[model samples]
Target chain A: MNSTAVTGHEAATHESEPGFYGTSWQKLMMWWFIIGDAILFGSFLAAYGFSRISAVNWPDRTQMFSLNFITVMTFTLITSSATMATAVAASRRGDRKAAFNFTMATAVGGLAFLGMQAYEWYHLIHNGARMDTNPWGAPAFGAYFFAITGFHGSHVASGVLILLITAWNAKRGKSGPEGVELTGLYWHFVDLVWVFVFGCFYLI
Target chain B: MSDTHAAHVEASYRSYWIAWAILLVLTLVMISISTKAFLIGGILLKSVIIGAWFMHLKHERAILIWSVVAGILFAGFLFLVIHFDAGTSLL
Candidate 1:
């Protein structure tokens, strides 16, 4: 056999093979996960679109939702995504301190977003929004609003927890640059989903 | 690290901030414009910026990039079909 040829024993001993996508396995797996999550969000938003189109008395989104508040939420998420990118970059450059700090900042941004979303939900529920019915023109409006935004909010909550853990591990040198990069990928994906949600549900 | 590498890192950092600025500007423009077409376009642009810069999809291989793009296109196809069906059913 050629020297470069892998024997069964050598292949068995190998821990990792080369990534098929020219990236690390961790990153490739993260991308696949993000794609799957994207489809989930896409399906939710598509259903929302169908409901809105079919409803005869769809509530006026402009009246129901505060655009200014949504803008702030958008700003928070986008800023957090920027911080996450910085954290990934810092980790790549071996600046663990910067990575930890930026990851913490991202977590803070996510918390702030969740807090604001909670307030929005509180206000809506107080104003008579429920799963089966709502003060809005169409009952499906409340259901879709709750389902889509609540699912996205849950993701933000999860991202915040992951960021906190990532920051802690990064500070102690437990997780490496790939971990931060993967977390950043998930965080950006959350922000991407919001971009579509904000447009389809709020603006359009 | 070499000076060239440091320069590249700095450039990458600069690109991230540039993308952030563009995203903010696009978002503000979207809020200002009430037109649906413009809003959809702005959202798409923002998604592109985030995917390319923050997620580093732009630096990835074409195969990886196409995989993502294909997923999004599939979602779009699904939406189109649902939208059409919903519209026709109501008519």
Candidate 2:
């Protein structure tokens, strides 16, 4: 019933070390990783922005992408992030059943998003999109699109795998609440990156 | 569980759903509008909501929050500087 004893990892950290900013070392390390990942995406987007501005005939996004379909993909990721948050909360409250269920739900959502992304890629490639060339206006368009979205998709794929493992561990009472929270952080970071990608690449 | 603790849990759950609703609304609005400025603003707002609410940054200490915010802003600044150079090179 100790409020500070929400997770085994956290309790252990509190007893031994004050911890940087009073957060578990594991959580702090995760944040650092997220920051580094953010920089990676930021650099990619920056390069994309340069290509967009420098290009004489940038491809028309409206013609290349189906806005409605992209919106659905966005919805899936956001909903999955919400479910991840719920899982973390449930785990913290000692409701392992709910936590496991929500974690599984989040993994399902991630799978759905990846499936949609694959379809989108297939649709584009079928229409002559490739790394070197495309039916689009700029040759760099194909390269940037593939690089950015492909990297993001890879992150989602890995996140789904991690979620499945987390759920399995939770069901077996092997992982603690901190594990759920850490995974949730990573999941939300993926969604966060998509917000930028959707806005910078698709909307704008 | 005590009544107060139960109520707290309920409120926390409700907040997550509320964040989700706001995110959906923002996405719809972003797509409906074609203005670049509005889209950028919407993306930034959505990022803040996701970080603060869903990621529980609001519950973290000031030092951690500032570290994250500062790190991202510095990266963005670096991007802008590099972009300016790229622009000049083309000119």
Q: How accurately is candidate 1 docked according to DockQ? A: 0.74
The 10 consecutive residues of candidate 1 chain A with the worst lDDT sum are A2-11
Screening candidate 2 with a backbone cut-off below 3 angstroms (N, C-alpha, C), the clashing residue pairs are none
lDDT of 2 by residue, B1-91 (tens): 3457666666779899999999999999999998877887899999999999988898789999998898778767766776765554522
Docking class of 2: medium
| Model 2 lDDT, full chain set | 0.86
lDDT of 2 at A109: 100
lDDT measured at residue B63 in model 1 versus the true structure, 0 to 100: 93
Q: What count of clashes does model 2 give? A: 0
The sequence of per-residue lDDT tens digits that candidate 2 reaches over residues A76-149 is: 99999999999988987789999999999999999999999999999999999999898879999999999999
Chain B TM-score, all predictions listed:
0.85, 0.82
CA lDDT, every model vs. true structure: 0.84, 0.86
